[model samples]
Target: MPYPLLHAKAALDELKLAARSAPGIMVGVTIATTALANVPGMGDAKANWNSLAKALEVEYPNLIGNAVFLSRAGWIADDREAFLNAASVFSGDLQKLSGLCYTMEGQVDQVRDAYALYWMEIGLLAATVLGYLLACQAMKLTPHLRAAGEILLARLTLLTNAMIAQKTKVLYGFLAVAGGTLATSSQSLGQLFNIQPTESAAINFERAVIPTDPPSVYLAPKRELPARPKQQQR
Candidate 1:
């Protein structure tokens, strides 16, 4: 019912609140998006998700983030915007950086590690793009269409969370590899000038997870995809 962006902003605001208090905790929040929030006879999926989130928030303390409609819509819109603006640039950067890192890796172990790291990075990025596109298609559904796009969006939310978790792992690998590369480059530069290389800062960050409720919680009962418009006989 709400503009996808507004829903997305609310979700981010919630996460920011959680982050401020429990800076160390990484929450896997989930949210459901449905136009049928107030519809009767059909399932009241949104309310159920809110209740679940509240329960989890209380039970898990800082471990569980609230996964409600706002957050789910917010994530989808935000990711779509990101892909629109920087997906191409980011993809290029990853390719270039991965190639550079691979060249720098000398030992067999280093080569293997770099290969695995880059492979996963590229794979995850591709997955992220595909997920975003799916979300886009789902969000475009109108009342004229019987199928609920929110249901598809709900499923994509789970996939997106998984991609985020994988990205975190790849990010940690990048920091380590980049740090070593910088250190190696620094040492080479320092040796030429008879100066010592500075120590690189250790990079450590917890992976963020944003999980959501199941599709049934977001989809309406008796929902069917909208049929194609039939041509009138002339």
Candidate 2:
């Protein structure tokens, strides 16, 4: 019923997420955009931002407009108008939210690929270095192809497993953080909708803030302050 608060809360959520992921996202986008921009005459680095915005607009073009219309039509509460200023409650914000999520996932995948690739490359580089070292140590100066190959394979497997474990830990940590956020947001939403915690939580909140006198004080026989004696009539 209170549309402004509802929309404000949603917008606030996007803002918080944006703030949280901003640093990593900036790194990812910088790397990604730089990588993408190097392709000669691609001419659409910004296209991603536009495409995402348009996609969101397609989904919710009337979001801000309708919220405005609702306010004018006396459908929403007065206090809630504060949320729909000139800039907010629009598809752009949602798209930003979507883009942030998309870019984050993209970055994670890129990093994963890079991690695997780097480890694989490290194994190759190490093998090459070790191979050269061995060749130098040899009297015949010919590398042992089979022995080097075996060592490389064994090292590669071990490195891959270690990387996998690290990635697994990261993925699980992401899940835990994501899950906890969702749970908190859901709890907030339930508070909004009166779906969870029943009446007791609110009552408890009130009691905590303005606590009742102890039961004994209320229950004990009260010693009333002596009534002011009536002034004698002149």
Candidate 3:
């Protein structure tokens, strides 16, 4: 098996694990978003929550597409070195994505803490002061979520393009090998039969006349010229 296929299989396995684990994380995000939306003073933060949700929606399908492509056996690296380079890039992207997930998780925790604090402060502070504080926290928390979501989308796009490029390289390599094999086999068979193949008439004709020659002497012009000079001497 190709090294790239092996790497893809490993990636697929990791993706499977991620798929299993994702719902729990998504549930947390959903709950947090819902909780924040209900909180009275979230203001423009609600739009950010909606944007994050839409980003996640787009991200899940892209992840699924990555898995689908990786599962394909045809997307192979041409050599061990190629596989190593691809694997390095893929691993780095995965690490970046993992870091973003961790960051998002921390952001979610912050939102939860803010939610809890809202209730605590509500009891002691005036309505106007409490609303202002909640709005301020929303302003800080929502931007981080949006940025992380955008980064995740970009990483997924890169991964998808990398897989496609690997597959294309493998396909071209296969075609080159096939063409070489066919030419070699044809030459071997010709030698074994002691058969010399003549050039096709079209090829012979093309070689017989230079493009600079007049059209009247286009056919075998060199042979025609020698015979014409002999007849004139006679």
> Candidate 2: lDDT over CA atoms?
0.43
Instruction: Give the lowest summed-lDDT range of ten residues in model 3.
Output: 28-37
Every model's TM-score: 0.24, 0.27, 0.23
Q: How close is candidate 2 to the true structure, as a TM-score?
A: 0.27
Give lDDT per model, in order.
Answer: 0.43, 0.43, 0.42
How well does candidate 1 score on lDDT at residue 112? 38
* Runs in model 3 lying further than 4 Å from the true structure: 1-78, 124-234
Candidate 2 residue-wise lDDT, 1-234, digit = tens: 243233333433332333242222222222212211121111233355446645665556566667567766543343455555543644555655555534434433444343334334333433444443344335233455656654544554344335434544564566566557556644643454454465646446554675446656444545889899999999
Which residue ranges in model 2 land beyond 4 Å of their true spot?
A: 1-143, 195-234
lDDT of 1 at 2: 34
The superposed Cα distance between candidate 3 and the true structure at residue 214, in angstroms, equals 43
Clash count of each predicted structure: 9, 0, 0
- Top-TM-score candidate index: 2
Q: Please, what are the lDDT tens digits per residue for candidate 1 over residues 62-145? A: 322232322445456657566445644544444444433333333223433443443344344444545454454645556643
